[model samples]
Every structure is written in structure tokens, then in C-alpha cells.
Target: MNAKELHDKTPDQLREELASLKKESFNLRFQQATGQLENAAKIRAARRNAARVKTVLNQKAAAAATDAE
Candidate 1:
């Protein structure tokens, strides 16, 4: 998913999405280790997607903190 999509989600939803992405990344790694992974590039994509979610989450948190101040 893209940052634009992630940005539209609430923090709780973003967190859930991050959790699923992390799980998928773990599974992808396991498959790679066992030589069952068909596409190595998927690992990279999953990581980047997770990172995007994380970035958006952080940005939201920062904005909230600034507003609170």
C-alpha cells in the first residue's frame, strides 16, 4: 500500500495494518529460508509497506503532540 492510503487510516487501523505486514514479512522470510519463496522481491515490498505505515503513524503522533503543546 502507499503512504496516501495509509495517511487516510486512523492510528489504530494503521497499527493493525503494521502488525499484519510484519507477520507477512516473517512468513516471507521463513519461506525464503526454506527455499519455498517464489519471489524474493516480495520481502522487500513487505518491509517497505511496513515502513510506510510506521512513517505515517509517527507523523500523526508528532502532529498530535505538537497540537497538544
Candidate 2:
């Protein structure tokens, strides 16, 4: 997913998506180890998407913490 799309997601939704991506990454890694992975680019895409979600989550958390201060 793109950064703009990721940023538009609610915090909870981002978290859920991140969790799903991580699970998918794990499976992708297993596939690669077994020489069954057809799309190597998918692993990179998943990593970037997971990072974007994490960045959004961290940004939201920081904003909330600052607001609470």
C-alpha cells in the first residue's frame, strides 16, 4: 500500500494490517527457503507496506502522547 493510503487508515486498522502483513512475510520467507516463491518482489513490497503501517502507527501514537502532555 502507498503511504497516503496507509496514512488515511484508522490507527486500529493500520495495526491490523501490519499484523497481517507480518504473517504474510513469514510465510513468504518460508516459501523462499523451500524454493517455491514465484514472486521475489512480493517480499520487498510486503516489507515496505509493513514499514509504512508502522510509521503511521508511530506518528499517531506520538501525536496522542503529545496531546495528552
Candidate 3:
């Protein structure tokens, strides 16, 4: 779940990872609302991970655009 790991993945793989992270975040929120979540920090972690995936994806797209020029 580190930037280096994400940086090496293909865009499609990154998208999949982002999707799973978002799903996890949603489930975490649901658990918190029901007062069943053991660790609230997990929600924050998931959110940050999703952001990292998005950042990497954007960087890849930008790089591709630059290379195309």
C-alpha cells in the first residue's frame, strides 16, 4: 500500500485497487455508524490509501500525455 508499490502497477490495476479501497472505506463508515467498528483509525487509513491511488493514477496519466507530445 506504499507509493512505490502503487507506482509500479498498471493504471487498470491501480483503478481496481482504488475501487476496493473505496469499498472498504464505505464499509468502515457503516460499521462506525452501527457502533461496531473496533478501530476508527482504519477509516482514515483507507481514505488516505485511496487518495494515494488517485495521485498515482493522475501522475501516470500526466506522464503518458507528456510522452505523447
Q: Highest lDDT: which candidate? A: 3
Superior candidate under lDDT, 1 versus 2 = 1
Over the stretch 9-57, how does candidate 2's per-residue lDDT look in tens digits?
Answer: 8999998999999999999999999999999999999999898899889
Tens digit per residue, CA lDDT, model 1, 1-69: 778898899999999999999999999999999999999999999999999999999999999999999
The regions of model 2 sitting more than 4 angstroms off are none
Please report, in order, the local distance difference test score of every candidate based on alpha carbons: 0.96, 0.93, 0.98
- Full ranking by TM-score: 3, 1, 2
lDDT of 1 at 47: 96
Model 2 local distance difference test score: 0.93
Number of clashes found in candidate 1: 0
Error of 3 at 52 (Å): 0.3
**Residue 15, candidate 3: alpha-carbon lDDT:** 99
